[model samples]
Target: MLDVLKPVTSLKLSTKPRGEGAVFKLHYRATFVFIMGCCILVTATQYIGDPIECLPDKDSIPQKVIDTYCYITSTYTLPKYYNMKVGVEVPHWGLGPEMAEDEKVYHNYYIWVPYMLFIQAISFYVPHWIWKAIQTDKVYTILMGLDNRSLDEAEKKDKENLLVKYLALHLHTHNVWAVKYIVCEILNFVNVLVQISITNAFLGGEFTNYGPKVASFLWQDPEDRTDPMYEVFPRVTKCKFWKYGPSGTVQKHDALCVLALNIINEKIYVILWFWLIILSVISALALLYRVLTMVSPSFRARILRQHGGTLRPSPLDPSARDAVDSLVHRCQYGDWYLLHSLGRSMNNLTFLDVLRALDRELNRSHSSDYDLNEKNLLKGKDVTSV
Candidate 1:
C-alpha cells in the first residue's frame, strides 16, 4: 500500500514514525503472507491426503489384465525410473498404467509440484532479508536514541535537536548508501522474474514435450484452446510403464495417470504470475521515484516549500530553535534536502513546520530586542533635551 503524497518519495518510505523497526513495506508483507499460505496448503494437501489419483486404462485391457496391475506397485513405479541404475535390467513385471487415455504421465509430478512451490516461497523472502541486513543497524541506533526519555533534560534536548539534524541531512544528502535501497528494489523485481522462469522450466515437462512452453503461451488465447493437450495444467497425462515378461522379455504398457495436484498448481501459478507482474511494476516505479528524489534538489526544495506552507508545527522548545533554524537554512539554500525517514512520525511535513515555526519565533525575539533598545534611546534623548 504505497500511497503517493505529492511524489516527494516512494510510498514505501513514508516519513511517518511507526513505533517499530521494519525493513519491509506493506506490499512485501502482503506478498510474503500469500506465498507462505500457498506453501502450507500444498504441503498439507500432499502429506495429509492423496497427492495424485490414478485411473486404470479399461478400454485397451481385459478385466483379468487390469486385475493383475496393483495400485501399491504402481505407486512405487515413478521413483524406480527416477532412481534407475546405469546398467541394471528392467524389472521382470509391469506395474501397469493407472490413468485413463486423456490423461498423460507426469513422471514424478507429485514430488516436483510441492518442491517447486516450497522453493518459490523461500525465494520471495530473500530480498526482504537483504534489506533488513542493510537497514536495521542504522535505523535502530537513531530510533533508540530518539525514543530514550530518561536522559538529563538539557542533554536530552540537545540530543533530540541533533537527531533531527541528522535525519534532515540524511534526507537531503544523496549518497552511495541511499542507492542501496534502490538496489534492493531492483533485486526484488529480478527475483520475481527469475522465480517465474525457474518454475516454468521445472514444470514445463508436465505440460509439453519440447522444453518450456510458457514463453509461447504468454499471449496465447486461453479461450481458443479447448484440447487438454494445450492446457498449462493438464489434469490427464498418458503414463507408460514397463512390464517385464519371462526370460528378459519386457512388455511396455501405455495408460493415463491423473495429476490431482495439477489442479492446485494451475490455480496457484496463475495467481502468482499475475501477482509478480504487479509487484514488479510497483517496485520499478518505487525505485525510479526514489532515484529521482536523490538527483533533483530543486524537486526536493519545491516539496519542502509546499510542506512548509501547508503543515502546522508541533509544540516547540525555544532552546532548540537555533539548531532547527540551521537545518532550515541548509535546505533553503539547496545545500541539503530533507527526506522522509519511513518512520511513521518522521516526514517532510513535520520537519518543514518545525522550521517555519522556528523562523517565526526568532523574528519575534529580534523584534522585541529592537523595540526595547529604541524606547530606551528615546527616553535618554528627551531627558538630555530637558
Candidate 2:
C-alpha cells in the first residue's frame, strides 16, 4: 500500500517554477493527491479485508451463502431504533424488528466509494489541466533560462535584452491569455461547489452537514450524545434473505451484518467535508484578489511595485515613479500578469531591471510612431502649398 502511494506523494512534492498561485496549487496538487490517496486506501481495504460479515439465525443456511447474498443484495438499518438500548430493545443501534412502518435505510453506497473518490481526484485536477493547455509554456519560452542565477552575466544580459524586445513588440497582446487564466481560477471555485453538491447527493444528503454534526457530537457530554458517524455510516445493519423450508413453504431469514468498512469511510468523509469547506473559502478569497487587481489600477501598481521591491518606505525617484505609473496605465491586464509571473521566477534586482528596460523600449516605440506621424503631416502640408 505504501509502495502504491509513493509516486503520488512524490508528485505532490515535486518542485517547479511558480506558474500558479498557492491556492491554485492547493486545488490541483495537494487536494488531488490527498483524494487519490484516500481512493487507494479505501480500495485496498475493500479488496484485502472482510468488508461485510453476516450471521444468520438458521443453522441450515450456509454462512458463505448468507454473507455473499447480504453483501451483494444490500444491507439496511432501521433509523428509528438508533437511540434504543443496545441489549434490551434492539440487537444493535440500527438493527431491529422488521416492521412495515419502520424505515429501511440501505447501505449500498459504500461499495462505490473508492470509485467515487477516484472520479473526484480527477475532477480536482481538471482546472489545472485546462490552465496548462491555455498557458502553453509561454512564460517558460519567454524566460529562456534567465531565471537561473548560475548563468554568466553576459548570457543573462543577452537573454534580458531579447525578453525586453519581445515585451515591447507584444504590448497589450496578453489580455486574452490573462483572462483565460482567470477563468481557470474561477473554474476552480466552481469545481469545489459542484463537487460538494454531487457528494452530498451521493451520500443521500448526509455529507453536507457531516462535519458540523461531528463537531457538535464531539462537544456534547458523552453520556447524552449519539454518534453522528453511526447515523451517517452505521457499523451494523440488517439483511433479509428468503429460503424454502422442508415443507416447501417460503421462510424469511434475517441476518445481522457488520460493516467494518464504515470505520474507514466515516473518517475519510469527515476529512473531505472539512477540507472542501476550507478550499471554498480560500478559493473565494483568491478570486477576490484577482478581481481587485483587475479593476483597480492603483492596486495593480502597488502589486507591481511590491513585486519589484520598490514599495519600501524609501520612495522612488520622481522620474522612476512616473515611469512605473505610466507603464501600469499603458499596459493591459495580460501584460501585468505576464510580468508578475516573470517577477516570481527572476531575482528582485533582475526583475526590476527587466521592468525598466521594457518601459524604455515601450517609450522608444511610442516616440518613433509620433515622429513618423509628424513627418507625414509635414509632407501633406508641403503638397497643399505646392
Candidate 3:
C-alpha cells in the first residue's frame, strides 16, 4: 500500500479559518488513531497471511510447532502461573457425533490454535517496530494544521525533504504497535485457556476423543484423583468437575494462575456472556468499519474533522461523492492519489494551522510583490520551535 505524497496543499476549505494549534491537534489524533487501527488490522491478519514482513523475534518463541507447544504449555500454563488450562476441557457441542468418529481432532485444534495465533501476533510485533523509523517530527510539520491550500507551498509546508520521502510511502507499520499487539495475543491466548478450564470445571464436559486417553493416564495416578477433570490448580477453588489436582503442591501452577483462577470454572463463560463476546464484537466492527472506509468511496466519514481553521468542513472530499456513485461509470479510482491529497493536506492544515495566521500576516505585510511569491511572504512550517 504505497501512499502517494502530495506537495502538501490541495485540501478542502472551511468557512472560518482556525489557528495553527488547532490543526496540530487534529493531525496528531488522526496520525495516532490511524496508525493504531491499521496495526491492529494488519497484525491480526499476519498469521492469516498479509505480509507487513516479519521482524526478528526477540521473544525466542520457537520455530518448531511442537516446541512452541512445549514453551507455552510449560511456561505459560494455568497451574504454572496461577490456575490455567490449555485446550478444550469441555465437550464439543459444536462438533456433535463427528467428535466420536475421530478423537484426535481435538488434539489437532489444540496444536493449531496457539501456533497460528502466536505466529500472527508476533508477525505484527516486528513490522510495527519498523514503522516507527518514519520521521514523525517532519510528519508533524505536515499534519499540524493544513486546511486551506491557499498558502504558498514554501510557507505552508517545507518541500518534501529526505524525511518525508523516506517515510510517506512505507508499507510496514510501527514497533510500539507490535508490542501492544503481542500483549493482546498473550491476553487472548490466556483468556481462551481460562475459558476452557472454567468450562471443564463447572460444566463437567468431557475432552471428547482425548477423554479416554487422557483419562486413562489420570487413572494411573497415585492419588484417588485420576480424572483429567481433577488436574486443577491447587489453593484455588476446585470446581466439582476436577478431582485430580494437578498431582499436588510442587506440581502446582505458576503465578498467572491467580488471575487465571478468577477466570476459570464457570466464571469465564459467564464473563464471555457478560462482556468479552460483546467487546470482541465491537472490536470486530471497528475493524470492519476501517476496512469499508478503505474500499468504499461511498462510505465517507460521517463526521470528518477540520485540519484548517474552518468550523464547517472537516478533512474529507465529499465533492468526489457523485464521481464514485456508479461502479461502471468510474475511471480507474486512484486510492493512493486521493489518500495523499487528503492525508498530506490534513497533515499541514490541521496540524499546522496555516490559514488564520496567514490572514493576519497578509494584512500586516507591506511588500513589493502582491502575492505569496514575494521574498518576505509569511511562512509557518517550523513546529519544533513552536
Candidate 4:
C-alpha cells in the first residue's frame, strides 16, 4: 500500500522539451529558472502543516533542500551500505519535529542516550577541520621568566631540544596534544570507512537503491467529536481522535517530529552528515601523517636543530649557508633595536636619562653642569654671565 502511494506523494521537479527545435531546447533552461523560483516560493510558504505552531512559512525548507542534495549525492555516489530512514535506520528521532511526528518517538531515557550522544559528538567536533583550513593568522611569542643575561650567557639559552631528539621535531608531532585534531581524525576515518562500504554495494560506479526522505504532518485530532478540522489534513486529527476517544489510553503526541521529518526526508540531514564526514576524514589524515613522523627519533633530532622550521639544513648543503644568511639578514634588518640599546648604554642611560634626552630635544634642558634640574631653569644664558 505504501509503495504505491509513495511515488505520487513524492514531489518531482522535471520538465520535458515540447516539439523540439534547437532553438526551443534553449527554452528548457528558462524553465529551470522558473522551477527554482517556484520552489523558493512554495518552499518559503512551506506551511509546517501541523496545527500546533502554525509557522508563518516553513523555516526548514532550506534545511530540507540541503538534506536532499546530500542524500542524492551520497546515494548516487555510494548506495549499498546506507539507509536513510529516521527511526528505523538511525534509531534516533529525526531532527525537525514534523518528520518524526508521523514516525514514532521513544521516550525511554536509556534508549535515547547513545543516539543523542552520537549527534552531539559530531556537532561538537566538526569545527576543527574548518578552523585548520584557515589557521594562518599572525602570532607573537614572549620570552617569560626573564632573568638578566649578557650576550655571552644568552648564547647558552639555545639548548638542544631533547624532546625533539626523542621524537621528531615536526609541528604535526607536537600538535598531538590538541583535542580537536584527534577527534577530527577519528570521525573522518569512520566516515571514509562507511563511505567505502557503501560504495562496495554499487556497481559500474553507478548507484540506484537511494530514495528520497518522506515528509508528512500526519497526526490525529485530540477529540473524535466528528470534527471538521479532521477533514483538512486528516492525518493530524486521526491521531487526536484516538487520544480523546472512548478507550482513553494516555499517549504521547509530537507535532514537531512530523514537520522535522518532512524536511529531513526531503534532504537536509544527509547533506550535513556528508560534509561533516568529509571534514573529519581530511583532518584525520593530516593528524596521522604528523603522528607517524613526530614519534620517529631520527626525524625528531633533525627537526630540533631548525628550532621549529624545515628538515633540509645539513652540513654539506647550502641550506645551512642560506639559513645563516637569512639569520644574518634578519639580525641586520632589526639592528635598530640593538643599535638603540647600544646607544642607550653608551650614553649611560636609564629611564631618567631617556626622559632627560627627550627634554633636551624639546629645548627644555638641564644645566650643562649636570647639577641643575630643567623645569627650574630660566633661559640658558640668564643663569650664565652673558
Leading candidate by lDDT: 2
The regions of model 2 sitting more than 4 angstroms off are: 12-18, 46-48, 87-89, 308-322
* Model 1 residue 269 lDDT score: 67
lDDT of 2 by residue, 228-325 (tens): 99988888889999999999999998899888888889999999999999999999999999999999989888887787454432364555556567
After superposition, candidate 3 runs with Cα above 4 Å error? 1-279, 301-311, 314-386
Q: So what's the TM-score on candidate 3?
A: 0.26
Clash count list over all predictions = 23, 0, 52, 41
Give lDDT tens digits, candidate 4, residues 83-116. 2343445322222223332443221121122243
lDDT of 3 by residue, 1-386 (tens): 21211111222223222111222222223222333333333334323332111111232322243233332342122232222222243221111112223331111122232233233334323322332333233334433334455657765555333223323233233333333333443443344344445434433243222234443664574543233433321112110011124455332211211112211222212322333234334444544544554465444322122212232343385322222232112212232222223343454333223223222232344242455554334444444347
Q: What are the TM-scores, per candidate, against the unseen true structure? A: 0.56, 0.93, 0.26, 0.26
Of the two candidates 2 and 3, the one with more favorable TM-score, higher being better, is: 2
**Cα miss at 352, model 3 (Å)?**
10
On TM-score, the stronger of 2 and 4 is 2
Q: Rank the candidates by lDDT, best first.
A: 2, 1, 3, 4
Q: Who is ahead in lDDT, 1 or 2? A: 2
